[model samples]
Target: DELQAQKAAIQRETDLADESPEAQAIQEAKSEVDSNNKTSTTHIDSEKEPSAEEIAIAQTAVKAEARNHDLANPSASGEDTKSKSETETEKLAAAAKAKKDRINNNNEVASNTKNLMQEEAIKASNNSDVPNLVTNLNQSQASD
Candidate 1:
């Protein structure tokens, strides 16, 4: 433990000594690199900023190409629409199956509860004391 504490104190002193004028010069060089990076980024961003006429021309070209594309491949677009319809149909069928499964589960639960209630009622009827008591009374009278 003493050895570890001594090593830690020595490391702290070494770190403090390393933070000298030479290290400060290196840090200044790094700050200059950071500033140069910021200036370069601003230059790139300014170059990338589009003019109003260029933006308008690009927008017009995009709209015209889009119109031409729709005209050129009307059948493909129709097929895409048909495929979407089929997908919706399949989704509807899947939803119906899910609903049917839920209904079947509910029916099964209801049937099981009904059967359980009937079984309990039958058990209660069979285990009643009145019939056994009447039978015992008749047997005693007969013996007398």
Candidate 2:
């Protein structure tokens, strides 16, 4: 009979996820006590979630750790420290810049490779064998 009543009460509430005061009253009333604890029936209260401040602190800590890691290993790419909700214009600009960057980067790599190959070819062509001065030295066991 108690279970049936609880079911009917929950049915009346309709949305269990609703956290408004009136909904909470309905939910609290429907909350059942453990069968083992027959001495008294107690409402089941869920553990409260972390506050905004707590969430901010956690976010800050994670950002700090990432900043430290980036600092320790300095790489070619630079990352932003702050998180922002990008506007539509900013997003489109970023996308365009990324495409332009890819093209430029490929060209830069090819140019660098060509310059390096030319320098190596020039060095190889200029090879004039200079005689080892040590070979012309006397090999006698006498004192210097």
Candidate 3:
């Protein structure tokens, strides 16, 4: 009961302090914060992707490890026929390069498309005669 009474007294003092002139400044600042939150949006940064060279190196290492493991426990090997492991590694490397090239080409195309779109947007926005052009078209249609 004593602790409850003490808490009540402390709360009353806190309420009285909040009504003071200094606390009014804090309240005004808080209002500005609330209003700013309504108008402003937070931006998130995107994650960085690995470069082509790094991806290629990692792929190469994985292919080499697989080949080494196969050679250590060869099911069949002959002079006439290159080991399946060797052939597989070559295919994987080629496939990796092709995949990388395709990705690069796609990125280039996407960048060009984005640039063209931005340029078109800029041109459209810059054309101040749009309203006049529309009005003239309307007048011509009315006459016809």
Candidate number achieving the greatest TM-score relative to the actual structure: 3
All candidates in order of lDDT, best leading: 3, 1, 2
Global lDDT of each candidate: 0.78, 0.69, 0.79
- List candidate 3 stretches off by more than 4 Å: 41-144
How much is the lDDT of residue 42 in candidate 3?
59
CA error at residue 58 for candidate 2, angstroms:
0.3
lDDT by residue (7-123, candidate 1, tens digit) is 999999879876988878888999999988887855556557788999999999998988877856657674466677788999999999998787667988767766777743334
The backbone clash count of each candidate, in order, is 0, 0, 0
Candidate 2, residue 81: CA error in Å? 22
**Per-residue alpha-carbon lDDT of candidate 3 for residues 28-103, written as tens digits (9 for 90 to 100):** 9999999988776453335767789989999999889878766555665556468889999999999999987876
> Where is the poorest 10-residue window by lDDT in model 1?
119-128
Worst 10 residues of 2 by lDDT: 74-83
What is the per-residue lDDT of model 2 for residues 12-69, given as tens digits with 9 covering 90 to 100?
6766558678878766666644344664535443577878998999999998988877
- The best-first sequence of candidates by TM-score reads 3, 1, 2
Give the winner by TM-score: 2 or 3: 3
Which scores greater on TM-score, model 1 or model 2?
1
